[model samples]
Target: MREISLDRLRTLVVIADLGSFAQAARQLNLAPPTISLHVAELEARVGAPLLTRTRGQVRATAVGQTLLERARRLLADAEQALEEVRGQVAGLTGRVRLGASTGAIAHLLPSALATLQRDHPGIDVQVQVLTSQASLAALRDGRLDVGLVALPQTASKGVKLMPWRRDPILAYVPADWQPPARLTPTWLAARALILNDSGTQLSRVTAEWFAAAGLYPQARIELNYNDAIKSLVAAGYGATLLPQEGEGPELDRRIVCRALRPGLWRSLGIACREGDGDRATGHVLAALKHLRQ
Candidate 1:
């Protein structure tokens, strides 16, 4: 048997609802003969009479009633599927996968995400904690929609990088240790340091800062998580240098943050696939740009 046409199903449904062939034809904006042909085709496909005329009123047979229920569900599902696609095309709803470092996710992303939520509630942003290199790699591999990366990165193929923010790298020390007003490379070098692991771009940036002063100091312990490093600093484990994101949280009472004498800074950039055209990612990228310092 051939397929049952949605138009024919609709005609039968309308005729049954209105109880008049003339009314169904008018409602469907189709001629009376077309309506009759639609019913004839539908009944031929079903191999049974689908409608009955009694007392000059139209009604459906039992088989037609069953088909009407299934047809209504199919029509509703088709309409819903189209609406969801339309929402995505309009940039009103979608899922965006974003990658960033723990520091960026903690201090820089909260306000931006809150703003995004307020402005585009239908957009869902999924954040993954990753190093700058890992984020860039994921962007290249099509595993990430967007990335917040450390700057001065060597250009990668198929990745576009845009300068986003530059934050001052400050010295975080134990409160009991009376540090100088401005911490110099020499002063910080004398103290035991809790540094970022060698794998991170932050570690490279910190190394360059010390190398500029002809001082290469060793760390007491190396770690990647900024919050954990801060916890150790509060416990008087060691002093560390890290960027203070704009208007970040208050420091622990046991720890003190001080300016660097030579004013070291950490630069960050936004990374995404070159020539990418995703609406949800575009919305997330815009929200992240608002955090630029």
Candidate 2:
């Protein structure tokens, strides 16, 4: 019986990433022959060829692809575990990977992360802007430690859901249009609509808001960014539905923000792996809760 080496696994990963054994050798600060020996060792242990060299390039073999995937997770887990142990010895210090929606990143996290950093100076926070659907997938896959997503999101048995805050949905029209103080569904639907991604939670709720009034607003444009949508609407291209929070204080000069007639709101919540023992995650989660108060 033979044991696989972590160093070999790491070199394999680096080779796959850099696309050449020579490049990987440089990155690992090892000689090319050493790199070849490492890969040869792994192939011998697994009874398979791990890579194939093409014209001036190197690519992973089928077995290599599978091993690479597992190796990455293993490496990440190993690194994270070491960080946790180190954190316990020193002041709290580890990386917390946070997945958040655009709105949450824009409006919510700046203050929360500021507080987290201030309270736990040693902890490093990394945030990625993701849609609710994407955030949920990442959370389940262990890529993200915590996700800030819309409520009523798909619940998986492996995660814990915590309600965060509700952001009101608002209507944006051309600044000079003189919109009514309170916008109506019928009136909103009649205008040319610029909405969020068709697959997003915001879009689904916007659809419901329209269906409730028995009107289907034809979108003049569909986009993922509020800033882009605002600029387009402000240019008198169309109207849009955007969450009230995270919107910049001064909108594009041409757009005016108004409250929706029925006062619609979308709830945001945090999702983390069930029974996660990471102290850094706990600290950031607590910071979010405190900021919300």
Candidate 3:
């Protein structure tokens, strides 16, 4: 049997992931025919078809799916080995893919990334804003090197989890409205409520908080961005519950930030692949860990 080619294996993985030969070619910077040839070569070597192409997408067969999984591991291992060598000889140099929530990206991540960039300028950090659930899913799919997500997450096998930070969930209400000093769920629920997107973890937690108080808040509107929620709240649309994020602009003078009764909190933490102990990823994780306060 002919030897399996690593480049072809990587090509197969990218093709399977993107689901388009043209897309895979563009991603790999190869010609479209080259992508097809790579798959053909792999099929010939394994004596089985690896990909079935359709009108707009491509999918792997059973044998191809198994091989694609193995190929990802192999490629990850090879890349780790190269990164290790670079770290030993020069310094940590590689890209670390990270996933975070909008709040984390706005408030928590900048400080850590600032220090990481100052220290290891060689390491490249790619960040995407995703909800905790989405981040966890990406981590399980091996798309993210590290995830700063809301806590109480169930780790997929081979994921290393650590506690990071706890943030108080605060309410934003119209500044002119004198919300009761003790903000009870029932009191808040009696008012028009605005909440995070309906399906987000934050929204779920918010719902639980209301439910625990024997009341429920049916939001007049749900939004994912904090600023937009604040804007809507300031316009007297309704009150909202959000992590206390203060960045781009001053809290709308018309909006009052208040802590909830019973002190609702959200937990966030770092998660990495268990065996990923690569120096580059570790350096980045350590940088984030240092900022855990």
Candidate 4:
């Protein structure tokens, strides 16, 4: 059996993520040839081409994807082993950059981070609020140690997405606008709405749902920030859709939040680079799961 070097495995993971040796090399700070040599060495040992390259983009072969999964587990276990040893001697200390959407940032992340901090005081954590796609992209590019994103990401090629939780997508109406007994397409179309920006998954889903129901809302304004939407709705500017749990005190007092009648909900969860088989990701995931439970 050929011994697998962690360095080679890391190289393969990086290439699988960035889809180009040059990009991976730049990320790893290695010469492109050096990175290529590492991948070639692994391919030689595995006896299969790990990457299928055409033009400038690269993708993992079936065998490569399978190996990538195992490699991620192996790498994570390896890092955990090292962390365990280090902790036994001194302590675990490192920074982890995590990304989340506005909804998660408002509802889920603070408690999760507080719990993690209680357990691992030495570890520093930073959180970035972004759209689900942006969060997934950051995770793949190795910028984030982990992220919480809505499901059905367009570029989830090398990611391990798991269900985090489901939250209701509520319709927010201004105080003056008399809302219907039920929020239906016909009823909602009569009112002006402040829709989420086109970039977010929420915006796409909302548009799809409305389109499917043959409802075109009266246009008022467009905004990316959910908080802004809530604020505008409160001030009687327009109605909007937001997560059920995302109702702030001020918004909750002023607006009526009700579940969308046609059963629209967002499935969200934690994700990380498959290569991040590290103690940090595992511990954080476990903590998150515990919180959800």
Cα lDDT listed for each candidate: 0.91, 0.86, 0.84, 0.78
Clashes of each: 0, 0, 0, 1
Candidate 1 per-residue lDDT, tens place, 1-293, comes to 58888788888888989999999999999999999999999888889998999999998889989988998888788789888778877888888888999999999999999989998898999999999989999989999989999988988899999999999999999999989889999999988999999998889989999999999999999999999999999999999999988687888999999999889999999999999567878888899999888
lDDT of 2 by residue, 1-293 (tens): 87778899999999999999999999999999999999999999999999999897899999999999999999999998897789855648878899886767887788888898788998888989888888889888989988888788768978888888787888999978889998999988777889997988889999999999898777888998777788899789889888877445677677888999898998888889999457888898899887552
Once superposed on the true structure, which residue ranges of model 4 sit more than 4 Å away at CA?
A: 1-91, 246-252
- Top candidate (lDDT): 1
Q: Considering TM-score, where higher is better, how would the candidates rank from best to worst?
A: 1, 2, 3, 4
Report the CA-based lDDT of candidate 3 relative to the real structure. Answer: 0.84
Measured on C-alpha atoms, candidate 4 has an lDDT of 0.78
Which regions in candidate 3 have their CA more than 4 angstroms from the true location? 1-91, 245-249
Worst 10 residues of 1 by lDDT: 276-285
| Among all candidates shown, the one with the greatest TM-score | 1
Candidate that beats the other on lDDT, 1 or 2, i.e. the better one: 1
For residues 84-142, write the lDDT of model 3, one tens digit per residue. 77774454587889998777788778888899999998888999988877877887788
What TM-scores do the predictions have?
0.85, 0.70, 0.68, 0.65
What is residue 213's positional error in candidate 4, in angstroms? Answer: 1.6
**What CA root-mean-square deviation does each model show from the true structure?**
2.9, 13.2, 15.0, 18.1
Question: Where does the lowest 10-residue lDDT sum fall in candidate 3?
Answer: 243-252
